[model samples]
Target: MRAIQITEFGGPEVLRVVDLPEPVAQPGQLLVDVAAAGVNYADTHAVEDSYLSKSTLPMVPGGEVVGRTAEGRRVVALTDGGGYAQRALAWEAMAHEVPEEITDGQALALVVQGLTAWHLLRTCARIAPGESVVVHAAAGGTGSLAVQLAKQFGVGRVIATASTKEKRELALELGADVAIEAAPDGAGLKEQLIEANDGNKVDAVLEMTGGPVFDASLAALAPFGRLVTYGMASREEPTAVTAAGLMGRSRAVVGFWLMHCVTRPGMYREPMAELFAMTADGRLKPQVGGVYPLTEAARAHTDLRARRTFGKLLLDPSR
Candidate 1:
C-alpha cells in the first residue's frame, strides 16, 4: 500500500510518500480500499505536532476517507489514522453507507467539515430562526456549508467574512445575505459586521480564527449572543477570555471539537444522517477545491496552509 508518512514534525515537506504494508481490520473494524481521502487543517496540525492529540512518529496521516469495504459497499468512514494509504481501517460503527447521488469526494467532505458545520449551528450555538449570524472564513469548506445551512435554519441575516473579494463572492453565491472583506488584523471587524447587519449586533457567531478576529467577534455579539470557537486557523496563540468581559453583555462563549462528538455515538449519528439527507435532496452541497494524487500530498498541504484554495481538498489514493 502507498501512504504518506511523517517521520518527524515539521512542514509539508516532511510529508513523504512511501510504500507500506496494508493494515488488517481488527474486531469491530472494517478494512477499506481507499478511493478518496480528505485533507484537513487537523492533519496539518498533526504534522506540526500542534494538535491537542499528538501523533506518533512514522505514522500515516489522515482521518476521513471514502472507499469500498470488502463487501463492496461504497461508504464514507472515519479512520483513526492511515487514510492517506491505498488501504485503511475504519471502525464499523463509524462507517456510513454513501448514497448513490453523493460523489466520493462529497462523502469525504461530509465526514468532517459538513458535520462540524451542522453541529456548530444545531448544537453548540443552538441558533434560532430570525437571529442574525456571522460566519468567518465563509468561503472555506465548513464556512461555505455554514452559510447555506444558516439560511436553511431561517437566520434572518447571514454575514460572511473572507480575506479575498472572490471568496466573499463565493459566500454570497452560497446564500449569505451579505459578504465583507476580513481585515488583516481584525481591526474594525466588529463595526463592519454591525454595519452589514443594519447596525444590529449579531445574535450568533461561528468563529474559528483566533487572535484579533476572535476578540472582535466577541465584541460584535449582541446581548445574550453565542459564539462557538472551533479552530484557531490563524495559528496564533489563543486570547484569554475574562469572565467580566462576557458577563456585562450576558454573552456566552463555547468551544467545539469534532473528536469529542465522534467518540460519543449518540452525538454524531443523527446529525450525520441529517447532513446526508440534505445532500441527497440538494439542500446541501460540499464544495471540493482540489483533487491531488496521493503522491502530491505535500502540494495539497502547501496550498491549504497558504489559504490559496477554497472548499475541501481531497487526495485520490487510487491515482
Candidate 2:
C-alpha cells in the first residue's frame, strides 16, 4: 500500500509518500480499500504535531475515508488515523454505509467537516430561527455547510466573511444574506460585521479563525449572543475573556470539539444521516474544492494552510 508518512514534526514538507505493507484489522475494526480520503485543517495540525491531541511519529495523517469493506459495502469510516493510504483500518462502529446517491467525496466530506458544522450550529450555538448569525471562513468546508445549515434552520440573516472576493460571492450563492471581506489581523473587522447586520450586533457566531478574528467576532456578538469556537486556523491566540465581561453582557463563549461527540452514541450518527439526506435531495451541497493524488499530500496541505483553496479538499488514494 502507498501512504503519506510523516517521520518528523514540521510543516507540509514533512508529508512524504512511502510504500508500506497493508494493515490488518483487529477485533471490532474493519479494513477498508480506500477510495477517497478527506483532508481537514486538523490534518495540517496533526502533521506538525500541534493538534489538540499529540500525534505519534512515522504516521499516516488522515481522519476520514470513503471506501469499501471486504463484503463490498460502500461506507464512510472515521479512522483513528492512517486514512492517507491505499488501505486503512476503521472501527466497525465508526463506519457508516454510504448512500448510493452520494458520491465518495460527498460522503467523506460529511464525516469530519460536516459533523463539526452541524454540532457547532445545533449544539454549541443553540441557534434559533429569525436570529442573526455569523459564519467566518464562509467559503471553506465547514463554513460553507454552516452557512447553508443556518439558512435551513431559519436564521434571519447570515453574515459570511472570507478573505477573497470570489469566496465572498460563493458564500452568498450558498444562501448567506451578506458577504464581507475577512480583513487580515481584524482590520475594520468588528465594524464590518456590525455593518453587515444592519448596524446591530449579531445573535450568534461560528468562529474558527483565532487571534484577531476571534477578538472581532467576540466584540460583534449581541447581548445574550453565543459564539462557538471550533478551530484556530490562524494559528494565533485570541484575546483572553473574563467571566465579568461575559456576565455583564449575558453572553457566552462556548468551545466544541468533534471528538467528544464521537464518543457518545447517537450524537454523530443522527446528524450524519440528516446531512446525507439533505445532500441526496439537493438541499445541501458539499463543495469539493480540489482533489489531489495520494502522492501529492504535501501539496494539499500547503494549499489548505495557505488558504489557497476553498470547500472540501480530498485525496484520491487510487490515483
Candidate 3:
C-alpha cells in the first residue's frame, strides 16, 4: 500500500508518498480498503508536532477515515492515526454503516467532520430552538455542518463568518441567516451579529478561530447563552478573556474537542445514529468540497490548509 509518510516535522513537501505495508486488523478491529480519507486541520497539527500527544516522526498522519473492513463491508472508521494510505485499521465500535443516501465522499465528509459537527451542536452547546448562533469558519467542513444543524435546531437566526466571499455565499446556501467576512478586531463582527439577530446578543456561538475573535465570540453571547470553542485556526497567538464575560449575563463559555467526544462513544452513540438518520431523511447534507486521488494526499492537505477549498476534502485510495 502507498501512504503519505511524514519523515520530518515541516512543510507539505515533508509529506512524501511511498509504498508501505498495508495495515492489518486486530481482534475487535477491522481493516478498510481506503476509499476516501478525510483531510483536516488536525493533520497539519500532527505534522508540525504541535498537537497534544504528538506522534513519533515517520508515522502516516490521518485522524479520520472512510473505508471498508477486511470482510469488505461498506463502512466508516475512526482512527487514532494512519489514514493517508491505501489501507487502515479501525475499531469495530468506531465503524458505522454508510447510508445509501450518502455518497462515498459525503460519507467520508460527514463521519469526522459531520460527527464533530453533530457532537458540537447537540451535546457540547445544546443549541435551543429560536436562539441565534454565530458559527466561525462557517464555510469550512465543521462550520458548514454547524450551520445546517443550527437550522435543524430551529435557530431563529444564524451569523456566519467566512474567509472569502465565495465561502460566505456557501454558508448562506447552507442555511446561515446572515454571513459576513470575519473582522480583524472581532468587535465589528460582534455588532453585525447583534444587528442580524434584531439587536439581540447571540444565544450561542460555535467558534474555531482562536485569538481576539474568541474574546468577541464570548462577548457576543446572549445573557444565559452558551459559547463553544473547538479550534484555533485563526489565532497563532493566544488571547486572554476575563471571567466577567461570563458572569453578567449568566453566559457560559466552554471548549469542545470532538476527538475527546468521539473517543467516548458511550457519550455519542445515540446522537451519532440520529445524525445518520438525519442524513437518511435528507435533513442534513454534508458538502464534499473536493476529491483527490490518495496519491495526491499532499495536494489535498495543501489545498485545505491554504483555505482554497470548501467543505470536506477526501482522498480516494482506490482511484
Candidate 4:
C-alpha cells in the first residue's frame, strides 16, 4: 500500500508518498481498501506538530475517513493515522454507515465536517425555529454544512462570513440569507454583520475563529443568545472575555469540541442515521471542492494551506 508519511513537522513538502506494507484488521477492526480520505485543517496541523497531541514522526496522516469496514459495507470512521493510504484499519465502533446511494467520494466528505455541523447545531445549541444563526467560514467544510442545517432546522435567518467575494456568494448559495466579507478588523466585522441583519442581532452564533473574532461574534448576538466557539483558526493563543461581557448581555458562551462527541458514539448514533437519510435524499449536500490522488498528498495540503480551494477536499487513495 502507498501512504502519505510525515517524517517531520513542517511544510506540505514533508508529506511523502511511500510504499508500505498493508495493515491487517484486528478483531474489532476492518482492513479497508480506502476509496476516499477526507482532508481537514487538522491534517495540516497534525503534520506541523500543532495538533492537540502531536502525532509521532513518520505517521500516516488522516483522522476522519469514509470507506469500508469488516461488515463489508460503506461507512465513515474517526480513526487515526493510516487513512492516507491505499488500505487501512478502522475500529468497528468508530464507523457510521455511508448510504449505498452516495458515491465513494461523497461519502468521504460526510465524515468530519458534516457530522460536526450536525452535532453542533442540533446537539449543542439546540437552535429553535424563528431564531437567528450565523456560521463563520461559511464557504469551508463545517461552515458550509452549518448553513444548510440551520436552514433545514427552520432557523429564521442565517448569516455567513467569508474571506473572499466568491466565498461570500458561495455561502448565500448554501442557504445563508446574508453573506459578508470576514475581516481582521473585529469592529468592522461586527458592524458589517449588524448591518446585514437589518441592525438586528442573532440568537445563535457559531464562532469557529477564536480571539478578536470571537469577541466581535459576541457583539453580534442578541440578548439571551448562545455562542458556540469551536476552533482556533484566528489567534492560536487564548483570548479573554470578561464575565460582564456575557452577564450584561444575558448571553451564554459555550465551547464545542467534536472530539469529545466522538468519544461518546452512543449519543451520536441516532443523529448519524438521520444524517445518512438526509444525505440519501439529497438534503444534506457537501460541496465537492477538489480531489487529489493519494500520491500527491503534498499538493493537497499545499492547496488547503494556501486557501486555494472551497468546500471539501478529498483523497483518492486507490488512484
Candidate 5:
C-alpha cells in the first residue's frame, strides 16, 4: 500500500510518500479500499505536532475517507488514522454508507468539516430562527457549510468574513447575507461585523481562529450571545477571556471538539445521517476546493496552511 507518512513533526515537506504493507481489518473494523480522503487543518497540525493530541512517529495523517469495504459497500468513514493511503481501516460503528447521490469527494468532506459545522450551529451555538450569526473563515470547508446551514436554520442574517475577495464572493454564493474582508489582525472586526448586520451585534458567533479574531468576535457578541471556539487555526497562543468582561453582557464563550462527540455513538451518528440526507436531497452541498494526487500530499498541506484554497481539500489515493 502507498501511504503518506510523517516521520517527524515539521512542515509539508515532511509528508513523505512511502510503500507500506497493507493493513488487515481488526475485529469490528473494516479494511477499506480508499477512494478519496479529506484533508483538514487538523491533519496539518498533526504533521506539525501542534494538534490537540500528539501523533506518533511515521504516522499516516488523514482522519476521514470515503471508500469501499471488502463487501463492496460505498461508505464515508472517520478513520482512527491512516486515511492518506491506498488502504485504511475504519471502525464499523463510525462508518456510514454513502448515498448514491453523493460523490466520493463530497462524502469525504462531510466526515470532519460537515459534522463540525453541524455541531457548531445546531448543538454548540444552538442558534434560533431570526437570530443574527457570524461565521469566520466563511469560504473554507466548515465555513462554507456553516454559511449555508445558518440560512437553512432560518437565521435572519448571516455575516461572513474571509481573507480574500474571491473567498468573500464564494461565501455570498454559499448563502451568507453579508460578506466582508477579514483583517489580518482582526482590527476593526467588531465594527465591521456590526455594520454588516445593520448595526446590530450578532446573536451567535462561530469562532475558530484564536488571537485577534477571537478577541474581535468575543467583543462583537450581543447581550446573551454565544460564541463557540473550535480551533486555533491562526496557531497563535491561546487567548484568555476575562470573567468580568463577560459578566455585564451576560455573554458566554463555549469550546467544542468533535473528538468528544465521537466517543458518544448517537452524538456523531445522528447529525451525520441528517447531513447525508440533506446532501442527497441537494439541500447541503460540500464544496471541493482542490483535489490532489496522493503523492502531492505536501502541496495540499502547503495550500491549506497558506489559506490559498477554499472549501475542502481532498486527496485521491488511487491517483
Candidate 6:
C-alpha cells in the first residue's frame, strides 16, 4: 500500500509518500481500501507532535477515510491512524456505511469535520432555539457546516467571521445571518461581533483560533453564554480567563475534543446519522475545497495551513 509517512516531527514537508505492506485487520476491525482521506487542521498539529495527543514516529497522518470493506460495503471509517493510504484498518464500531447518494469525498467530510460541527453546536454549545451563535473560520470545513447546522437547528442568528471577503460571502450563502471580517490581531473583534448581532452579545461561540480571537469571542458573549474552544489554528496563546471574571459575567468557557465523544456508545453514531441524513436530503452541504492525489499530501497540508483553501480537503488514495 502507498501511504504518507512522517518519520520525524516537523511541518507539511515531513509528509513523504512511501510504499508499505498492506495492513491486516484484527478481530472486530475491517480492512478498507482507501478511496479518499480527509485532511484537517489537526493533522498539521499531529505532524508537528503538538496535538492534544502526541504522535508516534513512522505513522500515517490521517484519521478519516471513505472506502470499502472486503465484503463490498461502502463505508466511512474513523481510524486511529494510517488513513492517508491505499489501505487502512478500522474498528467496525467506528465505521459507518456510506449512503449511495453521498460521494466518497462528502462521506469523508462527514466523519471528522461534519461530526465536529454537529457536536460543537448541538452537544458542546448546547445551543438553544432563538439563541445567537458565532462560528469562527466560518468558511472552512467545520465552520462552513456549522453555519448551516446552526440555521437548521433554528438559532435566531448565525454570525460568521472569516478572513477574506469572498469567504464571508460564502458563509452568507451557507445560511449565516451575517458575516464579518476576522482581522488577524482581532482588533475590535468583540465590537464587530456584538454589532453583527445587532448590538447584543452572542449566546454561544464556536471558537477555534486562539490568541486575540479567543479573547474577543470570550468578551463578546452574553450573560450565561457558552464559548466552546475546539482548536488552536493560530498556534498562539489565548488571553487568560479567571474564574472570578467568568463568575462576574456569568459566562462559561468550555473545551471540546471529538475523540472524547468517540469513547461513548451512540455518541458518535447518532449525530453522524443525523449529518448523513442532512447531507442526503440536501439540508447539509459538505463543502469540498479540493482533492489531491495520494502523493501530493504535502501540498494539501500546505494549502490548508496557509488558509489557501476552503471546505473539506481530501486525498484521493486511488490517484
What is candidate 1's lDDT per residue for 215-304, written digit by digit as tens? 989999999999999998888755647899889999999999998888786777788888889989999878998899999999999998
Clashes of each: 0, 0, 1, 0, 0, 0
Q: State which candidate, 1 or 4, has the greater lDDT.
A: 1
lDDT of each: 0.90, 0.92, 0.80, 0.81, 0.91, 0.92
Q: Identify the superior model by lDDT, candidate 4 or candidate 6.
A: 6
lDDT of 5 by residue, 1-319 (tens): 8999988899998999999999999999999999999999998889988899988998998999888898999999898889999999999988998888889878877889999999999889999999999999999999999999998899999999999999999999999988999786888999999999999888999998898899889898999999999989988754647898899888999999899898796788888889889899889989999999999999999999899999999998977
| Model 4 lDDT tens row, 139-194 | 98888889998999999889998889999899998899999887755657777777
Report how far off residue 42 is in candidate 4 (Å): 1.1
Candidate 6, lDDT over the whole model: 0.92
> Between candidates 5 and 6, which one is better according to TM-score?
6
lDDT of 3: 0.80
Candidate 3 backbone clash number: 1
lDDT by residue for model 3 (1-319), tens: 8888988897576888889987877898888887888888878778878765667867898877776666768887778789888888888888788766767877777777777887778787888788788888888888899899889988888888887999999999989989988775576777777887788888888877778888777777778888787877753543555577468778887777766766574655666677788877889888888888877887887888778988888887776
Off by over 4 Å in 5: 238-240
Model 3 regions more than 4 Å off = 184-187, 235-238, 263-266
| Candidate scoring better on TM-score of 2 and 4 | 2
The weakest ten consecutive residues by lDDT in model 4 span 232-241
The estimated TM-scores of all candidates read 0.98, 0.99, 0.94, 0.94, 0.98, 0.98
Q: After superposition, how far is residue 141 of candidate 2 from its true place, in Å?
A: 0.6
- As a whole number from 0 to 100, the lDDT of residue 179 in candidate 6 is 94
